[model samples]
Target: MLSLKKIAIPMLTLLLVVSAIGLTNAAPSTQAIETLNIGFMQAPSSTGDFGVRLAIDQINREGGIVGPDGALYRLQVVYPNRPPFAPDGVPDAVTSLVAQKAIAIIGPVDNRLAFPNLEVLAQAEVPVLTLATTDALTELDPSDNIMRIRAADRFYNEGLATVLIDERAITSFALIQTDVDSTEALLGFEGILVNRSLTPTVKIQEIDNSNLQADAERILQGAPAAVVMWGPPEDAETLLLRLRENGFTGLFVYRDAQEAVRSGAIPISLARGMMGATSWSYTTPTELGRAFLVDYVTSFNSIPTGVEAAAYDAVWILRRQIEQTGGDITKLREGLLQTPTIYAVQGRLEPSTYGGGDFSRAVTVYTMGDLGGPQLVARFANNVRLGDDDLVATDVRVVGLAGTLTYTPSPSPTPTLTPIPSATPSEVTLTVPQESVNLRAGPGTEYEIVGQLQLGDTATVIGSNADFTWLVINHEGQTVWVAADIVDVFDPGNLLSQLPIVQPGTNNPGIEPGQLSEGIDLTIEGVVLSPPQISPGQPFTVQVTVRNLGVNAAGSFSVSAILQPGNLTITAGSTGLGAGQSAIVTLNGTVDGTGSYTSSITVDATNAVLESNENNNVFPLTYVSDRPILSRIDFVQIPVGTAFDFAGGTADMIWTGTQIEGQNNARFGIVYAGAFEAVDYNAIDPSVVINFILPGSNIGTGSLIGFITAEGRRGVMRVDSLVGTALTVSYRVYSN
Candidate 1:
């Protein structure tokens, strides 16, 4: 508990008066009040300073914190010129703040700057509220005194994998990350996937000589299912645009460096379809958030980014700590840890073991789309801890708060307990899906077992635990509880939201395997064929989703994609799936013949699974066939680097204003580059080129210009030799 003592000034005044009347020998004393010194780096041009000033103003307006000795004190801001990572700024402005005895540090926002100073600040027992998104900052804090205002880095990794792999079924990808600390930490995540023997693949390619286009072309040539870029906002967006401009039709994923796109630094057309994750979005539906947006825009005349919002929240968090601790800096850390969740402009701010104040908060997955703005595509609530998949490494780093520090919950004296009425005061009907479900005396499985409920047994649920993972029920005239996952609540009503949050015991083992009665439960929810119609020899995708709909988890179930006629089957199965969890099996193969084909996707097709409904385990799919048409061709030559008009041309060259190699006008669907004779046009093969040779290389050609295009379309351009003002050129364009 915080040591907040409110002094009675009147009592002290009376004692002073008595002392003045010669009743005491002690001399009159003056109480000394200490100001809370918060150090932060002030940027020359930033709204960060404004945000801090606003918080300080609001705190002072509410009457500055009153110390235990009836002495009032206020926050004092300290701006240090040399923050960490500045030229020769190794000691940090934090070191100066420490010399001045600062109780807490507010910022020096960049992760590279803040990372090296976290341990130093924590060692001094000074708490920090940083705007950096690096997981390493909090991940390495020994004293758990460093709390991030923004979300950590690991969540971005989780968000990417969740969307690209789990949701989109994109199993293969390439990683191109900038050489930075945050991205460097994310480097070995491929090992996370490999260790688990996961099917999804990720190849991290080194930036070759810092040539983005060259490295990008190399990676895209493999045609990965997706591309994940982690770097500075501009670098990532630029890479995304280059990939798109090159006709790469795969997904792009990134971390929290999305503010650049939000600010429209990157053109909407180029950045469209690029996805990233962030903790807060302007579209958050809350009165506080709405008010914040208005106030921020009015103050700064611009939209607030996540950094500004987080900085604003940091000031408020420190203010609350000051008030709760009665201006005692020693108790500030405890005050922060024990304070109830604060509703801020961003969302509910809560302390987590991750050392971030809002670590477990949900993240909005945003994508720049054709709508000319960023749009929210999905939201993930739970914080994805450091090493969940192959894309994330197992971080031994953690903010160890448990067992060492004693957290005293804020004062809220409980009222006298009373017994409930037996006659179903308020009831919701729920059914236990399996036989022999343990009705524990308490909400968790670790509690004493009271009785057993049979399969299909209906119960009257009166209440639920905080997380709604367990429900209280009336059974045999005794109030008991069953795991919520095993029961189907027919009339949920507002029971979930209305239930008071209660801390569950450590033993809350969700339904265990031995506790379930094996009935029947397996389902093939859907069979989806991508491209619906496949041209001969082109690979089409088949996606099947299998759900474990039973009361218990289904184990080792096989799902097969069966193509009719030859009984060609592509089988994929999962090791296990918990109840309500679905496994999406994606199979890609070519349909060689030109004929309509039907596919039957079946879960447990071999009759190996026993479930509640066996009939619903099959999903039907149909795929159409189409023939590939060859493109038409026209042969003509235009002067290199010369402006040409193709507006009235009979052939569809669709002249783009762009020129290749400073010459050669472009066709709408093709790319061409000209080369001199000394260089081998043979060795110089570009992804966009097809074939090229001067009209006659054997005859002394003045300047041989070679051209190359995509595979489906072939184009040849020859330098017919320089003759007078018209540099004669011959070219033939062919399409399949």
Candidate 2:
């Protein structure tokens, strides 16, 4: 039942007409209007609100909905007094919405909040649109009133497995579950692997309770080709950073990567190339999805997250049902169940009969792009369960409404190259590995075909065209160029750098006489410090490897090591170096203090050598001495009683960083320092005794606290936020 009100403007106009007709006592006619109250139970700052609000505004602007009673109805969004994170928030919020006679409600997005209050919601007899991915929600809500907007955990897991295993051909996988909340999700992911008759190379559960450093080491020891991490955003960020720090350069697929990157818990630089699955992405391949992205960004002045897209779709879903059922609360649920598949911004959404209403079964697999956010890799839909033999690969190329997105593959690990000292300069050669390759007169195909080199044929690489895309080689003493991609160039000592840049033309195919006569090019090959990490006031020797990468031999030149912040310069004289020859020159320097400094090693610091490329002479070296190099972690959420290790960059039970109310005489307690920016790491006096205590009311957002770690390393942490049981902080720690 809903309340109806008379139209004031129509009643007022009728009264005026009656008075003009000399019938003042006649009853004035009126039209009734119905009010449809929809409750939005979420934090105002949540991104979900953006979509909900946008949908409501658009509906109201487009002349509202017409009810079954033949009366016009307007949608009104009601908010609860407390957000979902507040104490007794879910139950209280549901009670408030029910009392307010809200026919339907949106959110309590978190599974933890929604699952416990399922009974309260069911008893209220209100249709709810939930964003929770837990499959347990369907079982708990037997009434079928709660419809999930986002895809279930099983669908997301299956889609992720399909993308990684089937599409990418990832054989070795390591699975890590950091949050207990993601236990079912992790199982679903593992189930896919198990169903495929495969097991994860390594599985780590409850990583939050264990040492992350040791776990990272264990993962590295296993050496899986890719790591699939399932956890809360904060935990994912911590684990990801640890993995990268431990030099695990393999592919990383994190479930919470989107939220972590959006929240700035991890920088985009760190998140780049990471893969994840979502119900939707801004880079959705559908035209409807692309239009939604443009409209959302235009309205909000920012890109919408997956939660926002789901929430927006939820509002529209509710509106569609209400329009069909004409505001009848009893008919709305049936109408939703009978509703046809909706082409929504997320994907085609289908109503579930098995108590899992609006089960879209659509998931997108994306890899984070360089600057454009998530790039689409593959999309799974229509409850496509991928099997070993019957795999459906739907890799999509996403073209946004604004522009086309080029999906760049994840970067491979850089190969380490070791230069072997040779008595004679190493010769650079080009070999045709496959079919016969044409030897062009010039660098490009535009030139005439001079000759053809057969497969397995080798040639000496004498020079290259300007861009190095074509190599000029001496095949049987005949000068010709070959496409760089068609032939493999072997230059172990990088002797190709010494080769002359040949000018290619239609008239002249061979190298000109004056082109190869350029003077010696001196370059700093490598710089090796005596100790990688030095102590304060310690003398260190810098071994500078100077190489003559030119056609001619280089005369005597001085190599210098200039250490910054100390302005200490040490120079060593080199006898000389022949073409493609390298000489090690030693220069000694010392730093008087503990800090980070840059060492600039210049092979020809005084311009003593006339080289082909003067820019290649200097090589910059950055190293830290005795001082703790500060590592920054931003907006990382830690629950109460949890300990965070700033040095190790992980949050666990171990009391290394400050805990909310840690034990051990509050060894991990934090003392309120001044403003975050005011507390300088280098200026913090070790002598100033800090009284560490449990965080109080004064230690809310924007408050800075200084603490000494268990290892006696000092650190300063700024409280980014304190919401209920969760405390988010950004911190910088130094090595003692």
Candidate 3:
């Protein structure tokens, strides 16, 4: 907004004198033509001003402000050279310019400052080409003295209003902005949705610039599908950093990002996704402004100021006005009202015939590409082209109705991965070692052999030191040592050597089961050779045993132990020390899951597969077949604390047929309601729960059975499906 209020008095005199004299300075045949002083009130520190300067210089060199006689009117620029000013001083500066007789004004460079100068320029009836956004300045029709070639504030926000909704496929916009000018502009975007009668669920998170944390908390709570930061670079950048740090991963849009990108506050990678709109991508560029940009880059190897293109257009507007008007102020005014319609710096404005004010508001929405560079993404066509009164005025807000929303249950199954097996083992055994073995200083066979042993060599395997086996061997005529793996143990060594693992306990950085009351120091115990690899929030196993020191009934007692899959073994025995005595049971070896999984050892743990120990080697736990099993579950909410209402025992329950070789009917069930919204099957975990604890809540039981279906799924899970294997199941509960 330009204001020549201070210049009102003195500028009136100059205008009147000029009107009275009609002193059109004619070109002297002898040369040394007179000049025209164009008041360039732009901030010298501003990039837009430099652009305007370039255009001014180029025109002067090419015979500027071509007069009625065709003589070049040299432009003397007066960059507001005054120091910081109090209220009174600002007017003094403008009035001083009027006294100097500047016929027209270019800019004060910034939009906020543009208005003060507008008061004076508009007073002189001199049109000021503002290289900034904010249509309100022109909307005021302030003497028609303000003609903006550049877009105003709401320009980019409005463009993104559609772009984000479309390109990003977002139906929800979280409006997080500084509670200021941009905030209103962002909120102003609601009108766009309303005009289309489309209500978008918009949540507002007004970030307090001073408190980054509180702002971040408020935004996260807003649960916006996308955040539109409606503020300047300074505030937005700070908020963006906090948002990222807090892990609010989502899409973000910025209104003005030049400052943000160059600030180094927002990391470059994060800035790439940013989108914004601006009146001037750079300064003083005209229809051929892009060329000037390229030239500027070639010369300086950096991006020019944001206002550069606008400044370039400003000069072009001046030249075209002077040229078309035949140096007549009236003709120049008419051209300002017309041609340069599209205001393109590189190409002629798309339409070329659009009238000023409305058409000059043309803006090209841009996306921020790599390294904060700008790329034109789209240009909204004129509202006139709509050709219908159906369109409402821009900037209307406060619709009566809010947006709507719906919750669709996930159609495809929720993504789930086989939690890394509850067990990962570094424990290994070599069925056979090199016939002859060399013992080295380290556990590896490749280590330098410190001694040797032969085919008949005898060695006692203490235990595996690591992935390689450690052993003490007897060499002919000498005592030597070697890796048991290298020595070829006929049977695996006792695995207890790795037990009692050094572990974090009860305090911090330890297992949840181990978390005791706070303040106590976490005492690390011995490292267990094998810890089960298990899913977080899933039941894993740990084993502990107490020897019988007293007599008790033996019909069917239960004992519990976490399956030490790492040790690959379990142990039990009657030490038989005495009825009132005890001995170390040394729960020993077992082979099972590769990770730490907790399984209770029931004296009658009931579903124990009831097979003899020999069957451990006979059954592979998970068997491969021509088909695979795939089962999916849908959950309906159940209120907490209510007993599961499974169908009564009187009802007949049915087991869907299972094609998996050993899968029996009794292993699963689909009761009306059970514990949680959990659907389990052999495909994910093979432990067939052959026995169930009948619910006391109702005098019955319930279950979910997995039986065979179509082709099946890939066996990466267990067996390959496309390779002739994919079995699925549908289970429903029947009363037994």
Pick by lDDT: which candidate is best?
Answer: 2
Kindly give the stretch of ten consecutive residues in candidate 1 with the minimal lDDT sum.
Answer: 398-407
What does each candidate score in C-alpha RMSD? 33.4, 25.7, 32.8
Q: Is candidate 2 or candidate 3 better by TM-score?
A: 2
Better of 1 and 2 by lDDT: 2
Residue by residue across 531-552, what tens digits does model 2's lDDT show?
A: 4445566687765656565679
> What C-alpha lDDT do the candidate models reach, one value each?
0.51, 0.62, 0.40
**Model 3 CA lDDT for position 209:** 67
lDDT of 3 by residue, 1-736 (tens): 0100100112112110121112234233333333455555533324565566555544443233445554535554444433112223335555545555555566555544554444554555455666646556566654666666665555555666667666556766566666444444655676665665655444454544665567677777776777777665667777777788888777777766655676565667777767676654543233234455654554335566556666666665565455435444455555566653232442223223543353344445566678676666555433211222312212111100001111111212211111111011223222222246665433444434656655443444323333433543323422223654333333211222432221111112212323232221111111122222223223323222222222321222232233433433343433232222112222334343322233333222332222222111110111111111122111111111111111221111211111222111223212222322233222323243222322222222133333221122111111101111112112222111
Q: Model 1 over residues 208-259: C-alpha lDDT tens digits?
A: 2266777677667878877777666666766777778888898777654357
RMSD of 2: 25.7
TM-score of each: 0.45, 0.48, 0.44
